[model samples]
Target: MSNGKTKTDIPFRLDRLPWSRWHVLVVVALGITWILDGLEVTIVGVISDVLQKPLRWHCRHLRQVSWVLLLNRGSRGSYRFLLPHRQVREEEALHDHLGTYIVGTVLSAFSFNFASIAVFRIITGLGIGGEYSAINSAIDELIPARVRGWVDLAINGSWWVGTMVGSALSLYLLNPAFFPIDLGWRLSFAVGASLGLAVLLIRRYLPESPRWLLVHGREEEAKEVVSEIENKVSHQTGKELEEPNKTLEINPIGSVGFGTVFHSVFGRYPKRAVLGLWLMAGQAFLYNAIFFTYALLLSKFYGVPVDQTGLYIFPFAIGNFVGPLLIGKLFDTFGRKPMIAFTYIFSGVLLAITGYLFMIGVLSAITQTLAWVVIFFFASAGASSAYLTVSEVFPLEIRAMAIALFYAVGTAIGGVAAPSIFGALIGSGSPVNVFYGYLVGAILMAAAGVVEIAFGVKAERKSLEEVAAPLSEVIENPY
Candidate 1:
């Protein structure tokens, strides 16, 4: 309730709690951001066929919806650490969920041309970009550090769950028996938007990070939130909870400016910065290179109908989601460096082999998709881990901004050009040409793996404080 400095063990208290329904609630409520993001993109990918036509089954839209991905980097870092993070997240979610729910990209479906839809697409992109900092920060602070790596990977991996839903929904909606082609694509957006609104409702009951509250000198509020969590956990688990083992004396300060954060991230923690950049950019390129144009490859090279492409996404989405679940535990168990480096290099090597097979004209569409399933089984885990790395390696003071910068920079460096380049490769109808793109992606990923070997932070099972002291603690410890 006061702005005076407060000393509290909020971080220890949060990190020491046993697994309970409270954690599950935290995951479901905040984690939906990734799911909705995946759903929207997959829906676009699934319905690209229908979106090309609007009035009277005639067509007009972007060459592809890949531009949305590029623009998602737009609104990041705009709202970093200004207000309370949870409050900022709720506000962003309100704007994003409401905007989509009201008109959906159904407006895009009704567009007169590409320019019209691009406007709406840009709005959606900015809104989604606005959500990541808040979501990742909240999830990192709330979840127990012992399981942080896996939980983060699982939440990020849930994006594929959205892909599954989109693929299935598109199959049903895009069917001739169910709806007209134009109408079907619009419905996909509407459905995703509705889901967004539903999750927003759930997010309402979620509490602010007690760690955050304590640092802001809202000690009473922090204590109440932590106590309520303990009560729920104890009641639900039928066990008494042990006291937190340590305390943090947080001298609440006004704010850490963007300049101080930038210097700290790039200057004080430059090696960690390199690790984050490579990890993020590598996965960004690999995912964007493959995902943005897989449908075109199916249609142009494999003779699959555009409408049936969702069937291919089925197995692809399955492998992507499953990889994180099965491999995610190893991130915490085996440690972040080895697991991260292994996934990146292994997937990269696998992708290289697969690309060579693809270039030789030996595999069918089904077989190619199967290859992706294998490659991404490892790649998905790696990609999801990339976000976790950035969120955890930085000081909590700059965690939100650091994540925002890495995502934006990484996507720009790797994600932006891969799509257009790959689209042109697919346009050439040359398997060897497309494989060149795959080769580049493979090299990028493998190189990132090498970077991990050299520079990755060993953050597994460490409290956020130990990983990188908060800026307040930095002023106290020059070491």
Candidate 2:
């Protein structure tokens, strides 16, 4: 890697390895990031009602204001830009975020006013927001290309697992009879943050991305990491692993800048940039707008008590988690473009139909939740695929940073405003208004599906280098 020059078989070595304990370890180690995020979000959602109810009379006061608090968190995703240029190794970045979130989550234990809650949530968001880039890129690089889609989707789907657990726990925490209203809700965020300490410690045992290593002028470390992983895989399987399928040779560069990534993502691969944007924006809006604020809807129009909101959310979480767990393989088998498109389109149509039912007063609380279950069954898988599409389709030089960019941009375009728009609509206390919000989300998702059909890359089963060659390999921008 001297002079940022190296020819290596790192990609082939990783892509060729069979699923083994090492792969499982990789999944467990890196995959838990989503689970943690799910847990945090669920806890926040459940406690959100509690956050507002410092006084019984003032309970619904922050109903509309809660949406702005959520918007504050989404805006903190701009913290991701701080690392895109540097991409400090995974565990280190996780260390910074894990600690930052833990501290912020702990601080929320004392929040009373809108300002306090808002500030603490921003700190917490900054922590999680910065880490999304590291874990997604690591997953794609470490997992075998053969099963990358399934693994990625399944991991992404685990987000609901956290939500499920949070929702279930909320049933107890939100019960005024079970615990003091103020104390119970405050505990949710704190306890959720506490659980992350163990995961943060576990992540320390994980290795860096060999693909990342090769590109960053650390060829020897990359080889050592790969060799160690291969040995473990052999021992776990009691069989020799396959040899490299093909090697990626390049004049490895140290890093990429905004100009390089801009050219590569937009100039070199314009369609992919558009596809990534659409996929990311649609999912961000759908999740942030409708899904994040569901508890409020149940409490608002459905006349469901706040304590009971989680019970309804329970089935919804299961539907979302199961969607990608089941539908993930299709991304690998049916191909990335079609499966991504189908799921997005199908979910959008389902949501529109369900929104119509809700607006017409034909749906009960139970039916409305069930409708969410059916819709996110497809939507969950599609949303998970959005992250997958962005992570793998870019060159290795900018892979991790590229993911961060998409997430931040998506959060800006889709994440930041979706809540305020929907919040205003929900605050209107009209099902018709909320339905219009749902309609907007559905339109965005359906349009993204259409874009996928036109521009999505054929990345299924392809090595990272093959899907999009390392920037170093490109003659035009050889670093």
Which candidate has the top score in lDDT? Answer: 2
| lDDT, candidate 2, 75-106, per-residue tens | 45556566566747665776777677777778
Give Cα distance to truth, residue 45, candidate 2, Å: 1.9
Q: What's the lDDT of the predicted structure labeled candidate 2?
A: 0.81
Q: State the lDDT of candidate 1 residue by residue for 164-256, as single tens digits.
A: 888888778888778976677777777877787777788767887777666556689888999998899899999888888787766665345
Candidate 1 colliding pairs: 52-59, 53-59
TM-score of each: 0.92, 0.95
Model 2's TM-score against the true structure = 0.95
lDDT per model vs. reference: 0.78, 0.81
Cα error of candidate 2 at position 60, Å? 5.2
